[model samples]
Target: MTLKTCSRADGHVRAFPLARTLPLLGALTLLPLTSQAADQATGEDAAGQTASYETTEQAPRSEYLSDWYNQNVTIIGSKNIRFGPQQVDDIYLEYEFFGRKGPWDLYGYIDLPKFFGTGNGADSGIFDNGSPLFAELEPRLSLNKASDMDLSLGPIKEWYLAVDYIFDWGHNSNNRQSTLYAGIGTDIDTHTPVGLSFNFYKRYQGDNYGAANEDQWDGYRAQAKYFLPLATFGNGAKLDYVGFTNYDFGSDLGDRDASRTNESVVATNVLLYSFTHLRFMAVARYFHNGGQWNDDAELNFGDGPFHVRSTGWGYYLGVGWQF
Candidate 1:
């Protein structure tokens, strides 16, 4: 999942030593790019570490691909995702890309919601004329690589100039969203197999659904993402755990509406499985004041009065081709 429409996932690209850190589900590179350019992991060591990934298909534009990059195309089915006062189900197509070349580390994904057009009545497909395109892009600049400095100290191995940006093309001002998060980031060398990274961002909101805070500076986000190698199978199949958390705060969302909150939190946990070209994953996410909607508040839906249920769990099941 690239979002709750707007939340977190971290990475899913095979681009990192451990992996790309997106639930940003890693986001919005087009589908055509990664297939010919993918690096597929086909071998593993006895300890479950990835031994190597073979570059497959036609190579991407050589000028655009230096160092290493990875991409995957995924289809996700999700349930109980809250939108305002309703919890809707959806299925989406996801395209992901991640890589580190020289001073730049990049991650992004494109989410085509309602791509399949079949879901809990609320679902619409891109092809079915029932959908919108949503995507997120995150890019980080490494201080160590850019400045030729040894920025590592203690548990932190490097520092980065980080940014997260999201876009959704909806039908109207109330249905669309565009946001930017800019700040600093760091990679933590746990000295173990676990990989940890954190980014802190100052938010600049844009086109936020006709809210009172639209097109203005608002809030902050603290995000933590992690990866852990769990087990590897004899058949070269592998299982790993990856996840991320987004803590959003310092907003005035509650001031204008009773059914909204000043802060929110989204945490995602994923169990991912892989074998050759195939992939499978299950995700459990927790939301508190999701979409900045209050956990318990009353509001008029125009047609009637209702209580907003903003806090709870959302689930996603995904299958993908790691091209």
Candidate 2:
């Protein structure tokens, strides 16, 4: 049985898994971040720029040996987010960034969950001391840039040493989670309309709700991330479709081995509209055996009832300001 973190008014104890990093509008970080001038790093509208994975125009290797960065802050409202079995509503403040320098490509976001109150017992609001904070960082080293090589062959344009880092600051030390994923990644050129990239990572787990898998080598995650510019308004507003899929497997955390399952997947699709300083996003996400919990698994712990029903759909909506 899973541990219940919150007691319900109906005399049933429930588990309130902190909404781990609601990545609603953060998908823009994948739109290749608008390039800045060599001197001033101010952001501009570079949605259909050469930084796209499906970009047909290839810049010379000598051009990108310097720094280019952009940052933004957004307020997002997300619902039915399954960090664990139970879905949660999260209104969070997120800080997102993307940068490219020399051989490096980086993207990251920090989330302060429940910046607005969700009366659902998990988070009271930002002013509440019990709210959690979460973040994810991805840094990739381009092999082609590092070696000054022409690595493109057929559909593959570039290769990278990719890494993903996640940190969840829960309400207490016992509720925290820190995880690292490291492996190889590649950008694929479809030679069509969309930009695409893929990564395969091995997971290194850290502190996570005092689970049996803590501080150990756990599993693998194969992910595909892609984006497409959809439309542009006469007023300089732009629309885009950007999404990512995470397939996690190869672990002892699931099925007959544990209270959870050995595999899971989360697929998120989004629609984003951007104006000069305004951003709006809509997202639909599907989760199967989320957080490795089996949908049919039900058990009890410490005289309390614990049920695991983790498979379902989740949605997110956000309106924000991009700096």
Candidate 3:
């Protein structure tokens, strides 16, 4: 009586030992003892004496999970030389984690850039002065424009405590502003995964004119992002729709009482290709607010207390690669 074995993607199964088979009368009883030992070693105590394996075993799953969460980091930076409504040459850095056994995840990004002229002002060609230099030194300066950094540490498994800060300083008076934000949110798994985030922050705006009016803005912002995957492309092509709103509750300028509401919808799509990395995204934004400053007040655009109507829009096309 020789024992035979069959191996599949999961664990192997062996024919009952010749001596043990007679007691069971060839009933084909599973190797209960061996299965239980394997289960306990793998932390699957609920498996009891049953033999089972995951439908899809993703190669050294534990190692992959750890590397995916701890070592997987991405950095992206880009620059635009063409004169545009915003005249921005920016850099962005982002980090993501996908395998944490939690209802929520910690994620954040940093955006840094310089704008030569106001969003509404006529092009001073100042953004153009460095066009040639920027284009020539694209590889160098494009890596230096702006920085945005965010991190979320999970304390309650599925719930995460998030802290984010953004610093912008480039062109236009070389102004500097920083935001210190903290929030909590959850990741609810549904047909379309949903993420809800809330953040409150203190904003400090630095003035170039040596004015005593250097201001502080305290505000709260909330956002939700929904994942939409295309059935045609399966998981290869993914879409995300996000909505966000924000309001300011405090400002430093005296006699300046201000409140703002922002609503925005954005659609982002990932393109699958082997040769080139591509992504397309569109954004529609609406803003409305009043109080403290008149519609035309010379409120420092970067400072709080300024009202913005639903009259501005921003969109971008990006291509990136991972090494």
What lDDT does the true structure give each of the candidates? 0.63, 0.57, 0.23
List model 1 lDDT by residue over 139-235, tens digit each.
8999999999898989999999998887766666776677899999999998887778888999998877667788889999998877776776666
lDDT tens digits, residues 18-43, model 3? 00011111111111101111111121
Between candidates 1 and 2, the one scoring higher on lDDT is 1
- Model 2 agreement with the true structure over 122-182: per-residue lDDT tens digits: 3443467643566667788999999999998789999999987776666665667778889
TM-score of 3: 0.42
Cα RMSD to the true fold for all candidates:
6.4, 8.3, 21.9
Query: Considering TM-score, where higher is better, how would the candidates rank from best to worst?
Result: 1, 2, 3
Q: Which candidate is the best by TM-score?
A: 1
C-alpha positional error of residue 32 in candidate 2 after TM-score superposition, expressed in Å:
8.6
Deviation from native of the Cα of residue 189 in model 1, angstroms:
1.3
- What is the TM-score of candidate 2? 0.78
Comparison by TM-score, 1 against 3, better one: 1
Clash count (model 1, backbone only)? 17
